[model samples]
Target: MEKLLVIGLDSVPPDLLFGKLLDSLPNTKRLYRDGTHGTLETCHPPITVPAWMVMMTGKNPGALGIYGFRHRRGSSYTDGYIVDSRHVSEPTVWEILGERGLKSCVIGLPPSYPPKAINGCLVTCMITPGPEKEFTFPQSLKNEVRRVVGEYAFDVTFRVEERDSLKRELFEMTKKRFKLASHLAREKDWNLFILHEIGFDRLHHAFWKFFDPDHPKYVVGNKYERIAEEYYGLFDELLGDLLEAAGADVPVLLLSDHGSKAMKGAFCINQWLEREGFLKLARPPLGVTEFEKAEVDWTRTMAWGWGGYYARIFLNIKGRERGGIVPPEDVPALKSELKRRILQLRDVSGRPMKNSVFEPDELYGVARGDKPDLMVYFDDLNWRSAGTVGHESLYLSENDTGPDDSVHSMNGIFLYHDPNNHQNQIKSMNAEEVAPTILNLFGLPIPDGMKGRAVKLS
Candidate 1:
């Protein structure tokens, strides 16, 4: 096939691709009618950059060495660059496709920072607190875009609180870029084309109340219905437009990095760690002390990120641990005690999380190389897990800071236009599966380091 178009619609739930929402755009519904639809499992922490990189690289965080967006850097500002092609442990599909001498087009791909010299068109998406201005695509194309597509608001940074504003900006931006991307898709004669709205993720974070039955903001009255109704309508319309603009022969693939869940509160996993004696609290002496370790207000502390993907808690160890503090002999007892503590996590109300943890050993390959030390699931909706190796805080305030927004885990949407061989059943593949799947799709050889199997779609 000469053409493949994938629209990675950020937080778009699978429901948006079918059911009542289908009525808005008959064309898209038809795509779903014949296409394979399913859910996608994202990586642990379900973060934007890490998930995208893992999908492209086909390696887990352990191999890639990427975990989250912002790490407390070691005092170097420029060194705090967001993850990108430079940081990715493996070659991207673009690089691989490029090697095959097939031209490709990529738009607004996250973690594509410090953009490499791709064989075809390349652009960065989800830049920190800013716009696409930080991108490193070819200057010829990058400069030509301003003149051809009209002025883009590159200063716009994605924020959870400014849900409405962000969507409006993204909606407009996506439309413009889609036009350019479509043009490139045709003019460049590329074998594969990737376009992303990324707005769907933000929309869900901000307006989940409109769609989620569990959300308090959900209003059945005619008034607030417009919020969810209009956005979905627009979503369908944009996708339809892209499908129509591209030559119909091109297969289209729609995906979300991860889904979201509505959050009720934060559960301090670290607090439970302290209670279990897994974490040794550094209490200050009662008398004068020049260096008092910052008081850890454990009750109000939390380690959170947009975590519908997953979280893990392992027995901190000495040698194998990222930074070993605990001795080797203590590891056995610590692992058992940590496992017990993880099962007993309670919300502010003291309810048990049971076995919300992913149990990587069972789920994936839980072997040393493939899994995190302690694998678990957080309150997927809004509650995320945070903190580094040894930090006192774990829980953060769950109070909705009014109209604020964030991409959460609930249900990521899916559709496979030409699911050649593998039935695109409503199955779920982790973020790690993407790298392998993409490589397999084009008949390219899989790289040596990845753990996931290529989706044999032939």
Candidate 2:
């Protein structure tokens, strides 16, 4: 039986992996030289949660009903919920393998917080509130994890101003994560294994401006200029160790959920909506205010938007929302008008921003769950959406929620190395193709409804 190993490096962009840093990463570079590698086009919204799930299930975000990490619960504006393992209704690749009695070892996969039972060991992702809660499947694996690495770190606080402390914690978290992964690989009995390292994403968010000279906020003599290289080198070394533990014969799939790049700025979507008369506020906030906390005159508002890497615009339809105003019949024209106006929005410099607006039904054949009426990407996602109001200007130089320096990109990386048969091809692959490819490698049937074709390794 052939074993498969998947190393999911969250938010690792191809430019860094396939470009200048490749030479420094000897192990990864060897994979690049001998394996089939390319850019993996991420799903719509390009968020971590839905993107990973989409790859594992071969389903689009709409099919999974997950728009982003947080979702507006039903039609309530104020009520919202964070996604968890429970929200995943579709069967994952491991689950499909488990049915055939093939065991798996999954670690740090997003939305696996309330860790569910699998055929083998399982450790939840960063979303786990803390380690105090049960974070491992079968419960006993928690003891083994604690025995391996004292006090596991699911995530780190990267948005803080303490650069030195943040850097130390970031490296330490990744060290523990990979250490545990290596231990599991050597000890666990499994046909399929997966390890998702979120440190790369954190590193990009916290240190991109320091390393990337192209960043607007970059300074030539910044102290953290070499941070990206150091982190990548560390990751490559750890990856080499894990490969050794997993054995040289096992085929490896190194991929990322999404890519990252320096953020230009944040566009205050709510403030813009208020200025455009699409949203009505009962009273102006005295200071920066969250959209849910603001006094919104929902009765008069035509549409409102939630913000993150992208904007999720929702309409106030009559008979749908509590204080609905716009009639269902007027939704199409209203959406078209909103789309047109949003696309025409200009930057702070009076230059037009490259904005894209997509209707849920049009983008995804089926709109499910609490989907937004329209999705907007400002400046092709270089600019993030800010949901907060009370800002004098509609644009903010920093993230509305935190001090994030990077934004998610559509192109992540994909490298598949089969020691038995090396293709050495560089071709682009879609996110959905990952699962079907995995099933194919395992000699399993590519289940119906999986919207992807397996990559030919021969």
Candidate 3:
């Protein structure tokens, strides 16, 4: 069987590889020329948590019961907790391979907290709580990582407002993650090796304005203007190193969970809900950050939203939630009405804003308990949706979390290279196809539950 080394970057755009940045990324250019590569269409509500899980498990977010980094635990929007790998209901490709005596190494995949038992070593992702906790699968592998790379860094702190500090931490985190992954690739005896890096995503989120002068918030000739491109160069160099460490005969798969683009502003979704009479509050809050402590008139509330890289809307349905209002029989008409109204919303400047609103049934084939009632992409993903209430207006100049410059796009990257068997240039592939393709490459039967099909690589 061929040894497979999978390198997962959090957010990378195809345009970066084929456009002006091409000149600086010679290795990536070579991969494009010599192997099969194309845009990878991400899952619905394409954020880091669900996309990675869908790719690794060959299951859609509906099947996995995970739509984002956090999900409603018991039908109430406020009654939710952060998601971890334990929430995944299906078996990962690593576990399937491990069951058959294959050894693998998994590092830094997001939402991989509370690390589970695998065939080999496993280091959890950014949500590991902190470096003080034991994050490795074997319980002793943390010591090995510390000995080899000083400390394991799951991810860097990303803040668009703090340009210098964000850049500094991004570089340091990238270096440490690569060092540990390279060490494992060279030292460990494994058939399947996987590693993930969030530096690219962080860089894009914090500094996209620097690269795209067309961005609404772009500052011309700023010191940080070239920073994003420079980081792409670093990513290419690191890719070359990891490829070398994987040796000449091994095939390498490179991809990201989703792409990213410049964000113009944030849309206050909860405020919109309030204006539209979908949500009700008992009193005016002292501040927007007081949402957790605010008293909501749930009986009068029909819907509410939560913000992140995207927005999720939940309906207070009768017999389902604590203060249920919408009846089960009225769900279809209500969802259709809300979707129509949301799409008709305009920007602050009174210009029509473009968006795509999806019901869980349309996107995922069924109504699920944990999934949101509606998933939205605003202004073609150039604007974020803020879930905070108490905003003076429906739109804000900055993200609620802070000042973020970028939001996730639907198209990511997928490149496959096999020294012995290579395919022609492919146009596109879905995140779901990855796991079954890997299983096919390893001569394992494609599991019945997987919806993805194996790609032809001859």
Candidate 4:
């Protein structure tokens, strides 16, 4: 049986990996040239939390019962909770393999904070509050991780004003993560190993405008114009070293949860709702205020939205929300009206923005948990949805919460390198296919409930 190594690079777009940065990434480039690589279609609301979980569990967001990182708690207006490992009830690939007596080493898979016990070692993901808490499975592994990398970094604060300092922390965090990964690969006894790095996503979110000339905010000949290349080169070098540590013949799978691209701007969804009479406020905000902080008259409001890479709109329907107003039978008509108006919205320059709206049932047949009544992608994801209110205009040139240079896209990336069989081919695959593909590589049967089929690599 062949050992499997899965490297998850969060928010890596195919164009950059296979185009601009290809030559600079010798390790990734070689894999792409010799392996089967292509675009991996991400799940709806393509945020990291659910996408990575979706890939690992072979379950849709609905099945997983997680919509985004933060979910509204039982339709409470202000109450919400961040998703963590406790929320994931589905059996992951590692858990499934463990049942069959195969050991695995897993690291940094999101919503994995308060790390759960596995067949092998496990280091929780970005959601971890800090290293002081028990972030490793079996508890003893925490000491080993500290001995290897001093203090483990769960994530970085990317939405800061200081670019130089942010850049330094980003690279340092990645180096430490890879160093830990390399050390564990050599020391741990495991048939399967998985490592996820969030640095690439942070790089894109913070420095995209500096590197990509086509970005709306980009200026030619900027100081950080070459930052993307430098980061990609460093990533490739670390990847090469980690592969060496893993073994020469291990089958490697490289993928990302979702892709990243230049963010045009943020559309204040709640402000728009207020303007359209869907959301009502007792009084106008004095200045910019988060939706939760604003004085909302929920009794009069029809719908409200939460912001992220995409917009999640919830209707204040009768007998549903605490302050329900819209009648249950009137939901379809209201949703239709809202969708029509949203699609007709224009950009700042008065051009028709290409927006898409989806109901939970439309995207996932069996919608579950605290799902939004409407899922919206402003300008097909070019424009991020801003949940904050009190902005003068419906459009803003930056993210409402903080500084963000990029937004999530539907297509990420996938690369499979098999040393034994080099049947190089490029083909698109869905996020659900990854779990089954891993099972197939180890000659294990994919569970009947999995939504995807195994990809034939040989």
What are the runs in model 3 whose C-alpha is more than 4 Å off?
367-369, 421-424
Against the reference, the lDDT scores of all candidates come to 0.59, 0.92, 0.84, 0.92
- What lDDT, from 0 to 1, does candidate 3 have? 0.84
State the displacement of the C-alpha of residue 374, model 1, in Å, after optimal TM-score superposition: 3.7
lDDT of 1 by residue, 255-332 (tens): 777765565544455444555554544563343211113343333222211222345444434454344456778655
Please report how far candidate 3 places residue 190 from its true position, in Å: 0.8
Across residues 1-458, which tens digit of lDDT does each residue of candidate 3 receive? Answer: 75899999888888776667888888877776678888889998779988999999999888888888877787755667888978887889899999999999999887788888989889999888888987998998989989988867777667756678878888888888888888889988889999999888888877887778878878888998888678888888887888888888888888889888878789988878888898888887667854556678887989888888777888889998877999999988988888899899888898888888987777877545578888888878777988777778789888888767888889998888887765668767898998998898899999998988887544
Supply the TM-score for candidate 4. 0.99
Superior candidate under TM-score, 2 versus 3? 2
What C-alpha RMSD separates each model from the true structure?
5.9, 0.9, 1.7, 0.9
The local distance difference test score of model 2 is: 0.92
> Higher lDDT: candidate 1 or 3?
3
Write one digit per residue (lDDT tens) for candidate 2, span 1-458. Answer: 46999999999999999997999999999999999999999999999989999999999989999989999999997899999999999999999999999999999999898999899999999999999999998799999999999999999998988989999999999999999999999999999999999999999998999999999999999899999889999999999999999998999999999899999999999889889999999999989999999999987899999989999999999999988999999999999999899999998888999999998888889878989899999998999999999998998999989789999999999998987887789888889999998999899999999979987654
Residue 232 local lDDT, model 1: 61
